[model samples]
Target: MNSSLSIRSFAEYVEQFTSLLIDYSPKLISALIILFVGLYAIRIINRLVRKIMIKRELDPTLSKFLADSLLWALRLLLFVSFISKLGIETSSFVAILGAAGLAIGLSLQGSLSNFAGGMLIILFKPFRVGDTIEAQGVIGTVLEIQIFVTKLITGNNQTIFVPNGILSNGVIINYSMQGNRRADLVFSLSYDTNIKTAKDIVMQVMQNHPKVLKNPAPTVAVKSLTDSAIILAINPWAKNADFGAMASDVLENCKEAFDAAGIVTQPYVRESSKA
Candidate 1:
């Protein structure tokens, strides 16, 4: 009798298992189909997006990052669709995901902000790699723009990593955006020096420099008169690349020119023994 009872119990278990499989087979098959079709569609969409990015000449780093992010997001949506199609209660799962996302967002607030700022920068392109820019009280050539930070190489050759959040929100002076830059220089002359002669000498030095822009023309005007000396403001325009070199050369050449022309510069007098 015990043997018979065991055989009957085994048969009932097999019957229940078969019944469950039969009831869920169509749903399982439909879910599989949806998964395959969704994957194919995602692949096509990803390829199209990549092509658009390439055509637009977008930053490679930004393009790849966006592509991967989109791919994963699509895959996650597909997963939810597949599970829900199988008659599984997905509200709890979705709530769990939302809660987890909120927690992670709270934990990485700074990083997320930086990421958003980077996206804005990449899209708007206020500055590009190799451009000289001044921001956050640091002036440097942009080395690279990453998702969270931007790398810059200073004039002194020091590397700096500025968070994109601050960089995007701050005032950015892109020296390279405009092809030409104006240099403001001041030279002091003694009261005995002939103003016209000093101005002519400075103008000659600037005009003779190969890098100085000739169209806008350099200007020399008496800026101010102090008790000790007369200040002359010299404004010259040059290509951004040649600005530093041209400014230095013009100053040095002007000094030599002044000496040659017998122009008297203001002499520094020590007020006290300490200097």
Candidate 2:
């Protein structure tokens, strides 16, 4: 008698489940169809956006970032629609989603800040790939502009990943923007050295350099008079791409020229010992 009662309960449970399935089957099928259609539409939209970005010649990093963001946003919307189609309450789900999003956002504040910074950088055109910039105490060529960080390669061949948040907020010295750069150099001469003679030598050395700009003309003049020496300022203009090499060449060439001209630099004077 007890086994018969158990069998009857199991059959009743199965009947109830079958009724539920039959009642919801149409909604389930419709939701599935919508999901498939939405996904296909999203793929087409994504492809169209990428093509437009390419046609517009937008930055590759910006294009990829925007594409992925749009794809996920569409997928999220489709998910909400899919569940709502099957008689699920959406308001509570949306609220829970909002709460979860808020929590995630709060936890990833730094990363979000960097992401925003990257967007700002891409929009403002402060610098670009191949630009030589000095920021965050690093001077390097920009290799790639990513969604979170900017890649740079220094003169010493060191690869750096600088966070976009600080880089955008901080002072950025884009050496490549101005097309030209002036190198500020100073040379010391002995008190006995003739100012005019030393100036001529330095000026000639700078003018002879191939990378130095001639139109702006390099300048050599007395900067200051120290107790033991005369300081001469040597300022030269060069193309941005040539600035570093030109400055280095000028310094080296000037030293050799000074030696050939028998120009004496500041003499070392040892301090007297205290009694």
* RMSD of each candidate relative to the true structure: 5.2, 3.3
lDDT comparing candidate 1 with the true structure: 0.91
Report the lDDT tens digits of candidate 1 across residue range 15-115. Answer: 99999999999999999999999999999999999999999998876787799789999999999999999998899999999999999999999999999
List clash counts for every candidate, in order. Answer: 0, 0
- lDDT tens digits by residue: candidate 2, 1-275: 99999999999999999999999999999999999999999999999999999999988777888898899999999999999998899999999999999999999999999998999998887999999999999999999999899999999999999999998999999999988999999888887688888899998898888898997889998999877778899999999888889999998998888889888765534468999
TM-score of 1: 0.73
**Leading candidate by TM-score:** 2
Work out the TM-score per prediction.
0.73, 0.82
In model 1, the runs with Cα more than 4 Å from the true position are 1-52, 59-65, 74-91, 266-275
Candidate 2 backbone collisions, by pair: none
Overall lDDT per candidate, in order of appearance: 0.91, 0.91
Superposed by TM-score, candidate 2 places the C-alpha of residue 21 at a distance from the truth, in angstroms, of 4.1
Cα TM-score of candidate 2: 0.82
